[model samples]
Target chain A: MEVEKKQQCSELLQLVIDGQATQQQRHELDEHLPKCECCRNEFELSLSIKEGLKSRLKKPNLPSELATSIQSKVLELA
Target chain B: MSVGESMPYKSKDKQRVFNKEFMPHIDAMYNFAYRLTLDEDDAKDLVQETYLKAFRFINSFEEGTNAKAWLFRILKNSFINNYRKVSKQPNKVDYQEVESYYNSESVDEKITTDLRVETVQHMIGDEITNALNSLDIDFRTVIILCDLEGFTYEEMAKILDIPIGTVRSRLHRARNLLKEKLVNYATSMGYKDKRK
Candidate 1:
């Protein structure tokens, strides 16, 4: 792939992965992916990373006592 | 719109508003604090300090608006001003510099090959968290705000006090850095052809 085309593909890869891409941009990437091996690899990489983040990085739970502590602390300041 | 401006500052009223608006977000605040500090004691102290500040400046907050965002701004500022001083790693990059660097040609070239998809394909949650924690504070903050907290780019920009474009670029860089860190794990796991 040409350098500029490769760059364009790279930009689209981020937007698509981030869920920030527009419909037209997604369409453009979908069209480009099949014909280009490099872009496909890049796209798959981006997708896996995003999925990994979402599935693995569970939200940290707050300790049971933390909320009451915060509440009392704030009230003390009042 | 301004908090406690229209309504008189009665103690009972303040408590009511505090309970309704501010208290519900404790989990989120705690999570954000813990991620930033990476220590339970420090995170608790940070949250306590954040609440103290928020209550002290409750009058400044706009009522019925994004209290979560407002509290986040305070928490982030407190982390930088107080925690960062005691902590070892201070943010060294001027965001303007990062923005300019991303605008440059090097970023485009770097992204093309920096992330090897096969390497991180099999990473588990703990490994991913480790990768995230390994990042610099700025990069990690973006990931936490966007990926972990599900803040919109606009919300992240406001919370982090950067422009929307900076949020996007920083998030992009953060993810790529994470991918680099997890590459070894993915490589060891062996890339399965799951795409078919």
Candidate 2:
């Protein structure tokens, strides 16, 4: 594939991975992926990256005392 | 007129409104602050400052609106204005330098040699977290806002006080930078793709 087409596919893959792709754009990507090995690999990699980010970055547990402290501080300012 | 000062008729009403509206979001606010500051004490202080500001300007907040987003916006602004001011070590990235390097031919060669996702696939949670935390604050902020906190691009724009287009671009760049960091980790682990 040409560099320009490859770049366009890359952008589309990002949109698809981010869940920002329009339905029509998604349909186009779906049609294109099977025909392009490079994009297919890139799409899979992007999916894995998204999954890794979402699952691995655990939310820090808010300390039990923190909530009450914040409440008191906020109320003190009230 | 400072907060908690007796406003006669409005004090009780404001307290009730403030507690009901803002208290529940303390955990979310703290988590966001923690991610941004990457320090427990700073996170706590940031949250305290955010709540104080929220209450101080409670009258400006329209009831029944998005309290969470409003608080997040205030926290973000406070971080920029206050936290960044006091911190001895600032994480400022020169975007022009990064962009020029990324667009250079040598960088293109380096990318082809350096980036391999197959090994990144095998990385564990701690490795991923470290890779993310290693990014510049601006990139990390976008990922934390969009991915971790699940803010929409529009919401992120409002919270970060950037254009929606900027939010999108930053998120894109952030994810790519993270991918690079993970790939570096994979390389250090001595994983090789025989198929390549």
Query: Which numbered prediction scores highest in DockQ against the true structure?
Result: 1
lDDT of 1 at B173: 68
TM for every model, in the order presented, reads 0.82, 0.83
Candidate 2 local Cα displacement, residue B40, angstroms: 0.8
In candidate 1, residue B103 scores what lDDT?
55
Best by TM-score: 2
Q: Summarize candidate 1's per-residue lDDT along B1-196 as a digit string, tens digits.
A: 2446554557887788888999999888998999999998889889988988888887777668888988998999999998887888855667677666555555444554555555565566888888888888999998888777777788888998888878887887676667667764454556544453
lDDT of 1 at B156: 84
lDDT of 2 at B122: 77
- Of candidate 2 chain A, the 10-residue stretch with the lowest lDDT total is A1-10
Task: Report candidate 1's interface RMSD in Å.
Answer: 2.9
Docking class of 1: medium
Which 10 residues in a row give candidate 1 chain A its minimum summed lDDT?
A: A1-10
- All-Cα superposition RMSD per candidate: 3.6, 4.5
